[model samples]
Target: MSAPADSSALLQTPLNALHLELGARMVPFAGYSMPVQYPEGLMAEHHHTRRSAGLFDVSHMGQLLLSGPDAAAAFESLMPVDVIGLGVNKQRYGLLLNDAGGIIDDLMFVNRGDHIYVVVNGACKHGDLAHIQARIGGRCTITPQFDRALLALQGPLAVSALQRLLPGVENLVFMTGHGFNWNGADLYVTRSGYTGEDGFEISVPAASADAFARALLAQPEVKPIGLGARNSLRLEAGLCLYGNDIDTTTTPVEAALNWAMQKVRRTGGERAGGFPGADVVLAQLDGTRPLMRKRVGLVALERVPVREHVELQSLDGAKIGEVTSGLLGPSADKPVAMGYVSPELAAAGTRVNALVRGKAVPMEVAPMPFVPNRYYRG
Candidate 1:
């Protein structure tokens, strides 16, 4: 795992002590001293999550709450997602955009009945907080839950393991969340995760985080995983990593995230073109503006492991784009990647080459979710 140059200034999560006790290799990530892998190794941890359940400590991410009668409507004005139309106890993927339609950050927001619960990437939490407060602070009250700890139990057996501790959790379908009580602690759990698996992400108070993690780890089907496996898992699922795949320079249309924008928010819908960059985004959606580049999935024809920043080129050697994320997928058992390319070359089965170490490695544009998603939507 690559870490920042200066690791001394990193913050520690509530589970830091437990991670050390469990023999995890700590590394600097997003200003935190996080576990990159455990003694079981990245490969083992990656496979464990695919076959059974793997517990992850994601406390470094930001959690916040927006409360007010106007919270939903005010929040909807910041992004293209239909926050006002979202049902209570349901969640939706959202993008925070700048005036030019470039993605400022990508996050998940859940309507918790009384308030909106938001989770942002650890690296961008501070910025996201200020952005939200500055844009919609007048319409709603913003509260940051930075002290809470989050845990993800992801895999095929995740439901069975989690239900033993919280009996009714199995009833929550994908993209939904519910408040629950566990051993006198207030918990907010959502049936969603970065990995394309049946999973749940639980938000517990910082004080009880260690105890809660231990309890979940005690389940026979659960094992501790780290950031290394987490990246590979999400990559196999074709999910975007904020800074890597999408950033302040990328737009929703260019990133192939049109599905995240509902019809109600699009042009001709009841509430159209109110959010930041709506003019640019709506134009791209309606085919008025042409796209120069687009994000696409790629599979290497050779056994070589293509990595990020590798230049993508046409069959005859014209530079088209570059890889944003790539790895030899542990489950897909091949080199898979997500990158940007000329719109004309973004289709599946389109042949291309990845310039790795001055050599041209053959590749083909492929459909995303390199592996099939196993989300329990029902």
Candidate 2:
């Protein structure tokens, strides 16, 4: 395992040199040096991704393995998702909860036979590991896979570009995963990703990451994307970012992630719903009391991009909501955003006003996926 750095000065991934060579404007994000945008700027990068293909280096994320005689039992002791029932190679999106039922973080768990492979947010990696460690109670082993690099190939042309190199990867359906060899490097490829487009996330050894990324970019349709475009792309796709979209202050029900919870977990024995904060989480499951509606898509009428925590109000002056993630939608040619609001105002088409730079900006509650998701859901 690679130990975390002692200082906060920006860490670099294996692809750091590749990004600099492309003339990307490097920015510090989640304690790592990352490209915020390229010579094309954020707007162009955003548009290019929607129309073509974009490659992203997400190696800053933490990858880990949990395996032992009691791996499944130990896993169920922490997260709200069902680990025992997860079929091999299937991926499940779930949340890590505090004892009070508030989400500590959201993560993806993949069953890799005897052990489970986990990927967590980069910013919360250390805390997440500590949380899992303290609760496992000698039932399982927690091994951090710092030697791996994660890459996301997203957008309409993603399948074509990746298939051109890997040959036959286009057969993977969404949320399913498999192991493959690419240019002498082993990869764990998943037909799923953060951006709401047809894509794959490939996990490879850190040493081979840069070369693999360069190979993918060598294709005509693929371009190197930066964090700036990645943020806008996910927002447009209606995906949530940890820390901003959700955190320890919110529940899955409020975040509209109730579907991620298994039915058995909701009704099984005392131990079934026995994870931390089960009372609050299960209560939200039983009835819709004290709902904290997660914001979906919002269309800003003004040119300025609405940012986080901006107050939202009704046309008649009644306070309505606040923005969580808002920005210009280069694809829609308008500004878009998302925020929490009273349930009554959470319905689609509800008219609202965003306090943008102190002036009222007309906006509306629109259906999410600001653009339709092109995921290969088969």
Candidate 3:
């Protein structure tokens, strides 16, 4: 996909100079001139991550802290997740929705005991904050942690590598985090990542980011990975990339993210139908209103790979859907994609055709996480 076409100068991450020093191929992404790849290409970086650990500079993401007694309730007014019930230090994936039931953005929220901490997508961060402030600022204190840098350490060996720097981090199973003193710098490290691997996302002071990244890279198991690898990794793991697999026009139900909604917000529950779009979302969840179409995973049956926006047609030449995200999955050794289609055609094992270059390429509705997830939930 083409980067945003605005003529404005791109922003730079705190690790921008470090990326250049490491021979990164910089490209404009989400208003930032960030590295898409490095000396090692995408494929190598990907496989290396699956086998060992990959370090990613995710400082471009927005980090915000919400404090005050009304933080949970104010935040809960936005999405349907049980924010008030979210346990301390436990993070949950959530969606921001419009009143019309369309998704505004997806984010990770953690109940930090004393406050609520959230990480949102880079491109939508400013608007997301503005919306939150306009709606809930009177109740909660919203502070953007721009002075902090975010980093991801992911793969099968991620725990071992991280434990070397900060012991007891391995004790933080998936979806949990807490403040720690690492090399004398305060760090909030979460045992969670986008790659579907057993990994961690660490938030540190921007001034200490470069040095910390260097320290991690010095480990034999960790190597610097760029956005090119990052995209492929998350796609293979069946994770959605905001604006691609999901957007303002897509609802959480249509996007197959219904699991993100908690029981407390469902029918006959304590907080039922209180969040934005709750009426629409609950109708779909309770089968009061069936969804017309649902997002599904697709795997090309042939060696030829397909790209996004390619029309999916029935065998008789009727369009059913369009590919939202597609790529030659390195782990699958085949083209994998995800898109929305009629409810009947959303089942796994269903057959469809993708129109590529005016010809139809056969595909199957396969299960997601084209690569198996290895999260350490235990």
By TM-score, the best candidate is: 1
Question: After superposing candidate 3, which stretches have Cα over 4 Å from the reference?
Answer: 1-8
User: What's the TM for model 3?
Assistant: 0.97
State the lDDT at 359 in candidate 3: 91
Q: Which ten residues in a row have the lowest lDDT in candidate 2?
A: 1-10
Please give the CA lDDT of all the candidate structures: 0.95, 0.85, 0.90
Query: Candidate 2: how many backbone clashes?
Result: 2
**Order by TM-score, highest first:** 1, 3, 2
Per-residue lDDT, model 2, residue 60, is 89
Report the lDDT tens digits of candidate 3 across residue range 169-246: 989989999888877799999999999889999999988889989999999999999998898899889999999989
Q: List the residue pairs that clash in candidate 2.
A: 99-277, 101-277
Instruction: Report the number of the highest-lDDT candidate.
Output: 1
Query: What global local distance difference test value does model 2 have?
Result: 0.85
Clashes of each: 0, 2, 0
Residue 307 of model 3 has an lDDT of 80
